[model samples]
Target: MFQKILCIILFCTSFTYAQEHLIVIGGGKRPADALNKLIELSGKEQGEILIIPWASGEQEVGFESIKKDISALSPIKVVSAPFAPLTAESKIVLLNQLKTAKGVFFTGGDQVRIMKVLEDETIFKAMHERYHHNVVFSGTSAGTAIMSEKMITGNGKLDVIDGTQVETKKGLGLLPNVIVDQHFIKRQRENRLMGLILQYPTLLGIGIDENTAVYVQNNKSAEVLGESQVLIFDAEQSKEAMKLYFLKKGDKFDLVKKKKIKI
Candidate 1:
């Protein structure tokens, strides 16, 4: 009997824990296929997905818009986290929802605004902890920006490729070792991302174009999905010179290995 209990304990302890998966869209209209994919990964009718719209000026409007889009995709139970400037009482309720959420989405607006409420230590810790334990996180625009640990504020130098000219802040840290940019090709916002990559050579820079998304299911199976292209600034691979990679739909990259998968 003791041997049986010990074997069970060993099996449970040795089981591998899952890592967070990300599906971040650059600022623009999201494709239905992408929404469909999110629904599939989020466990559809089996589990709940939480959406946080603190980034938008009108949180309710933003929340409803995404909830509607997602609901149109499937019968997934979609819940909204209370908008930013959360009170202690409301935060508690939000936290409970977050805990049970199989997936989470952040609506587009100002990345700074989203970070303001998320910066609360307790709230931040809860999110960080859940992400590590495997949650599918999806977002658009500014929501995409908040996925990294060091986030670009989109407020700094626009004309030049100078590291010092860019303004940035600590982000939600869901996707570490990478700085994410939204609305890349459409906005022609390459200078800022290149500059940041030069400044933080150790970090990888991913510029996701409008309507496009880069989904990372662990670091090994990162792939681009949607209509546009995603630019990759891989300074981590070669510190001496930065190489720019333009990826379209169906392209895959190993984020940890910093290599492109030919598929």
Candidate 2:
């Protein structure tokens, strides 16, 4: 009996170490087909998946449906981040869940709220460790914005950006040297994103439209997936001036590419 128990413990430990996956879903409407494709790409069955809906006011609506949709492929364990009445114990629970999860996903909501809750050394360290271990970290919509070093914050309205109005803020710093903006074409956010890029020419501007995603790997090379195109703004090789007032909608900026994409 003692020998059997010891063997069982070892088996569980090895099993836990074998599962490593991450998926980032940008907010907007996630197509059922796209969700399944991501699950398939992760190379893990849905049964091993773990969803972290931290950005949704800590609400469960956005994640619940995703859980249901993905479950068709396999069963997924959905975990909600603590909100409103955050306690030490609740925080620990979230950390512990992440530590053992095969995959971690961020749901869309308010980016500021998500950062306010997770901007700590301990949580940051855990995320770093998990990413280093090859855990898949992904988010949608507001969740996607927080993955960058700088993120746009405020309402998706044109008048929201005139006369001393600033909508960008420091983000989670997960994706170093980049700034992310979401709901691009659907909300006509290109002008605002361009303004941000001009303000910080050193950073790369990545605008993900609705139903689209920029899947970034550990090496920093990313691919755009979904129904929309990802606009990449690189000021490294541009000689044109990026004046805030002179910017126009749908203006194209040239990027210095190491390799041209064939598609």
Candidate 3:
């Protein structure tokens, strides 16, 4: 009976990890197919998606537009959680809403804005709790930056990579052992991403191009999607200069093993 109980407990832990789903998109034209996939993973037509537009400067207008776009996906409900002054009543309301949400979507703008508003909130903790079970999470651009614990701030333009040129801050911690960079190829952000990875070799770097995305499942594997490519940098695998790999749509990769797979 003791052995059986231990086996059951381990199985349950693995099951919970397998249920975690995340979609990180590069900023540009929103990919309709990827959005639909997110909805499908979030319980499809019956899903209730919570949109957090805290990252955008124009909160009200930004959230309104986000709601309209998500609604077009035919989900049962799409709710917006604006970046507002939090109060006891407000926190309660937000937490209540989050409880029933099948998915949470973060919009694009300044990553710092989202961090400042929701970092320490009870609602953030609530979302993290739901995430482990089955709640699907999606974010774009600056919203994408917040998915990792060490988020890259899109500051200081440079054509060449050097560790000192980039800046980073604590992120939402949704994706561990990783740092994400958005608007990659279009903005010539290779150096920026390289700088961060070189400075911190322990962490893996994922650079996403505009109109492209990486759909990560269970934090173990990720697949490339959308119009462009997703770049993966593994400093540990390098012998001399840092090496990088580019994955296009339909390509699957093992996040933990750090290798491309047939999927």
Candidate 4:
């Protein structure tokens, strides 16, 4: 009887520890409902939730506003992270909090700011560890962009003569060799995404639109949710185009199959 009880206790403990999930929201206005859903999936309804609003111009305003907005979701507790003038001590505090957080939310702002803070090894390790243990890591807008390996930073203007351009950078690589772009369809970001794909055909380009999300599981499969579509551009099999002009919007590239299909 004691052996059976011990086995049951161990099983319960293991089950409780295996519930991590990532909710990546595309940039735009806001996504309150999606945020709540992510919280629900995290499994700990009454634990600490860390909100990082480092990406906005008025970091304080962004953080406070998000706090108020998220209040409706009624997270057990919400803590704001230090934004401007980042300090090592403050970052360590944030990392410590993240180590046992029920869920972490990255507010929309500037991806650059988010990148700067996440570059720290301690914070990165804590995040990766928590995520591996099934703690939810959620981000929106610029927050969403840095979740992947190759991050797209510039606006997707796509006109060199007109001076409109898009820039790409090395991302946190938390998601591995994946390039993530936000405000996808609303900004017609496919052109820039395709450009990146043409250069590195083996990499996966994920274009997430406003109010939508893609939940990646164990870094292998992802499921799309929300009002918009997640455009996945896979170029592993594309024969190098002589001029690279044949590719157009609405073109489909199968990530799993590594082939192109008409959208």
Residue 192: error of model 3 in Å?
A: 0.9
Q: TM-score of every model?
A: 0.93, 0.75, 0.91, 0.78
Q: lDDT (CA) for every model shown?
A: 0.88, 0.62, 0.84, 0.70
Error of 4 at 17 (Å): 5.0
For model 1, the local distance difference test gives 0.88
Best by TM-score: 1
State the lDDT of candidate 4 residue by residue for 1-263, as single tens digits: 99999999999998777765777888765565566666675543577777888888887787787677667776557778767557877877776777767777888777887778777777767777887787778888888888877787775567431212567665656677677778888887777877777777777778888877777655665666667777776666663541221222233343354345444
Candidate 4 Cα deviation (angstroms), residue 103: 1.0
Error of model 3, residue 93, in angstroms: 1.4
Superposition error at 32 for model 3 (Å): 1.2
Ranking, lDDT, top scorer first: 1, 3, 4, 2
Which candidate leads the pack in lDDT?
1
lDDT winner between 2 and 3, please give it.
3
- Give the alpha carbon lDDT tens digit for every residue of 1-263 in model 1: 99999999887874566666789999788867678778887788997889999999999999999999888889999999987799989999988998899898999999999999987999999987777777788899999999999998989879998878999999997888999999999998999998889889988899999989998876456788899999999776565689888898999988877879977
Candidate 3 Cα misplacement greater than 4 A, ranges: 2-18, 238-240
- Per-residue lDDT over 169-211 for candidate 2, one digit per residue giving the tens place of the 0 to 100 score: 7776667776777787687777767666666677777777777
Off by over 4 Å in 4: 1-20, 155-157, 160-166, 241-263
Model 4 whole-model lDDT (C-alpha atoms): 0.70
